[model samples]
Target: MTAPGTDAPSTSAQDDVLFTGVVVYSTQDPEASAVLVSGGMVAWIGPTETAEGLHPGARRIDATGCLLTPGFVDCLPTADGAAVDDAWRASAASRGITGAVPGSAGIREGMRVLSPVAEPLPLKDLSAQGVPLAFGSLGAEDALDPWSWVRAAAHGGDPAQRISDRAAFLASTRAGLRLLDVPHPGALNLGVEATLVVWEPWDFTVHSSDIRTNAWSVDPRSRTPMLPDLTEGAPRALRTLVRGEIVHDVPGALG
Candidate 1:
């Protein structure tokens, strides 16, 4: 039997990705430390020696004095871009966080995410249309297929997955934004019925720009224009500037 909040009951005992060892983060702790991940979620975290001593046959990763932090979480006011909520949950689960909510008004993206598994049913609109469906709306516009995006964003990625392709969605959103002006920092997605909130975290020292706003920046509303808001760029930018490493692989929202 699985323990509470530990691992779900597995009918087949399969070898899963196990991250056992120290973890460094920009939040909760600044110094180097240890962490543990199982089934893509952070099951335990502690000092290096403690985390290391937990399990055997696990992937022993040396933080090598790298900075670790909870994934950057930007609420409504900041751009809660894609590839984060999915990617973080997978890898960061091993570090310490399992799930994070994304804040935005891009419901269409959610639909796209579920399109492949099923015939993209609009759960919400379905109720209105008097249609019954099982499953909730999935947002995948800014979000990419996890494994696909990872490969695309990783070294020698396929150019087809570039952010430029997302410009089409931006174009459509821009047209919508014209009818609905962008919201203020505190109030985003004002006209929209349901907006998703995105939470983004950083792996290294984050800067003011990481969550701060700029002229083109708006808050609380789903990010429009297919491009990441000014604040969204900061996390990936700072991560690289700080450690010369790529945590989320900087899924470029815009060129």
Candidate 2:
């Protein structure tokens, strides 16, 4: 879980970073103005002034005009013969994935590609390495089929059905895998490791009305793009953190 030129923020008093002027999508609340990270956890969250006052010595990450949300957690199963390498990690980082399942992959020679099978995933070991592990089909593109089906059923249809579909997708993204019996997965809760992603939408404004009435628009800033927009690509991942360590910070991506 290490990246070149990126080290975990220290636990010392001077290591704190007051991340201010961004919309924080914490699990505790759907939104916050700021988040203070210390020792790889969210120490506090509030207005910019309060966060600055509480940690005067902390470095400031001015997140003005940005939208921050929990990092994407991908539970990818390793190809039995292909060792996980820097390329994969780099690719994941590019997609706003800071933490993943099976942090390390095994190596075997003479195979071009390997298929995923229904084997017991190393959830505990990966979690130990700070991977936000989950069960189910991370390796399959159709893993989101169920979500899509429900969403389609809700489209221009019953309001109750839309709400149910939306709730299900949110749970699937956040904590449903654990409910289905995956062990030791990460979550965006206070006191947990600081593994989160910040996104900046290209053209869309994540409106307050949409969050309440539109089931399809769950956190429009999310890089995953809960709502499929054929006209525009999903939001950009401005920053990604694993255990409060900056894994990806795209310069000039957000302004």
Candidate 3:
């Protein structure tokens, strides 16, 4: 029988990737310290030393002295200019944002939409280009509703799987940010797609950005690296992954 409060019941050795030497933040553990990924989903999570024995064949990536978390999921208000699609994606990837739900009024290149389009071709094109499709009604016109949307979705789910407000509003790249009644909006659980991000811890010696905003200190909302309102100055994204693929990676981020 599986022991209570332990993830051994779901552990498996077929994972494709293993991340070690970093602190993993998830709905299951605030700092799990290690994560195992397989087939674009998180297979298991626990201590770093124990991970190797679980998946010996997995590709090990060292994240020494860094903070590991889910990649950011941007809400509405992305630019619709096709000419700047690459630039927009680069900027978002640099900031640890792996997916986005653009405003309905504009057609932003490479954006994932909350609601499905009437035409199947457009949806297929986006998916072919690596965009995730989900359902919802979050529009740019309804700006004030997002605050409540963020709160309800992040904190109102199963206690163990309830995602941090930061992760739900900032690091959830799976689309479907338009409703308030969904279950576990952004919880990081086993068998879920491995969309992840890494951030370098700030030491007194390193030259880190000091872009402090009101959101950081606020109780339910910490100004994580990937909030849409955060225009300038924040911790670096370091690395990002979508469906276990390296969507963005900077020098020294893997280590």
Measured by TM-score, the strongest candidate is 2
What does candidate 2 score on TM?
Answer: 0.57
Candidate 2 lDDT, 119-202, residue by residue in tens: 233322433454432222346654322223223322323333222333322323444234324332233446656666766643
Candidates in order have lDDT scores of 0.28, 0.48, 0.49
**Clash-forming residue pairs, model 2:** 71-196, 71-197
RMSD of each: 16.7, 10.3, 14.2
lDDT of 2 at 93: 63
TM-score of candidate 1 relative to the true fold: 0.26
Q: State TM-scores per candidate.
A: 0.26, 0.57, 0.52
- Candidate 1 lDDT over 204-225, as tens digits, reads 2211121333333323142321
Q: Can you tell me which runs of candidate 3 are displaced by over 4 Å? A: 1-15, 76-84, 104-185, 203-233
Question: Per TM-score, what order, best first?
Answer: 2, 3, 1
The best candidate by lDDT is 3
